[model samples]
Target: MNWFMEFLATGFYSGKLPKMPGTWGSIFAAVLAYFLWPSNPDFQVLVILITFFLSVVSSDYLARKLGDKDPDQVVIDEVLGVEITFFLLNPQGDLELTLAGLILFRIIDIMKPFPIRLFERLPGGWGITVDDAVAGVLANILLRVIGGFL
Candidate 1:
């Protein structure tokens, strides 16, 4: 079952699991966030912040061990990024906001704007994960601003 563990850890089977692994991972993370988010807004914000930070650090290492430059199979970064976006919006479990946040995270991640492209140049798994994290941060700020106005 060693192979199975590697497959699961690397998310290699993610492609056959239904939706794109990146998207599916994000959805799964969001569900987790929904359950973990505290009733107190301050605590929820703290949880999001900590989750984003840990996701970046851990995914970086995991990507390197799994090999491949930004492997499609490694999607925890996407999960964390989408979680960061939705958390910033403070959606109160609104499905519309969740969908929008997912779209926004995916778009920004694909676009790789500005410093995000620069971050990708860093060596190893840091290169793999940092760019996406930056994209997530940017998307989070934009969503927060938009949420403020609405």
Candidate 2:
């Protein structure tokens, strides 16, 4: 159980990287989304929502063991963020669009502008998951708007 939590918290070990674990986790999420993305919008929404809920549980439990509000190595939040960002845009297998979404989501997550930062303090895994979820929502809107122009 402990190792399983660590595995999940580490975003399948992408978070174990020496630097920028969140970024690595996001990258992993992007690759996963590219390969396994669903064609149906309903399914995409379902998958991301489930991932978010599971991440919240595992992340909160692991955060408790680590004695940190949000440990750097706990990056399932990154996975949730990336999944949410890609859910509505239909980026799927499009390399350029997926890359753009990844970049945008990471920037917003890293910067945590406006309410993004506020969501980080929501308590337990809710805090850990939502900040990045907000970033994902922002990235999704931007990606949709920009993808329309290009």
Candidate 3:
């Protein structure tokens, strides 16, 4: 059960990487988003929503079990974060847009500015997952707003 919890938390070992585990989890997320999410916008949104819900629960459970405030090993949150970016911004799976969202998400996620930082202080899994989700949303909005100018 401990192994299972870790497995779910780390996004199947992506987060176990010694360095930049969160980034590794996001990379895993990008691949999953590219390959698995349905082409239909509505179905794609559903998939993203489902993944996010599961990730939150998994993260909470792992954090509590692992006895960490927000276990660094729990990077399913990163998957949720990046999924939010791609789902909200590039539902069609445009490679360029997806890549852009990835870059923006990484920046905001790592920087954790303003409300992103605020979100990180929430209780349990909410603390672990929300900061990145907000970052993804910020990235999605920023990308869309910037795309408008291009």
**Candidate 2: residue 76 Cα off by (Å):** 0.6
What is the per-residue lDDT of model 3 for residues 4-122, given as tens digits with 9 covering 90 to 100?
77788899999989989988998888877766656677976787677677778889898888788887778898998888787644444567776777788899898888978988788
- The sequence of per-residue lDDT tens digits that candidate 1 reaches over residues 81-114 is 7666765355557666666676778888878889
What is the C-alpha local distance difference test score of each model? 0.64, 0.89, 0.81
lDDT of 2 by residue, 1-150 (tens): 889878987899899999999999999999988888887999998988888888899899989998999999999999999988887666667899889989999989988889899998799999999898889899998888988899
- Better-scoring candidate (TM-score), 1 or 2: 2
Candidate 3 residues lying further than 4 Å off, grouped into runs, are 88-93
Candidate 2 or 1, higher lDDT: 2
Best by lDDT: 2
The ten-residue window of minimal lDDT in model 2 covers: 84-93
TM-score of 3: 0.88
lDDT of 3: 0.81
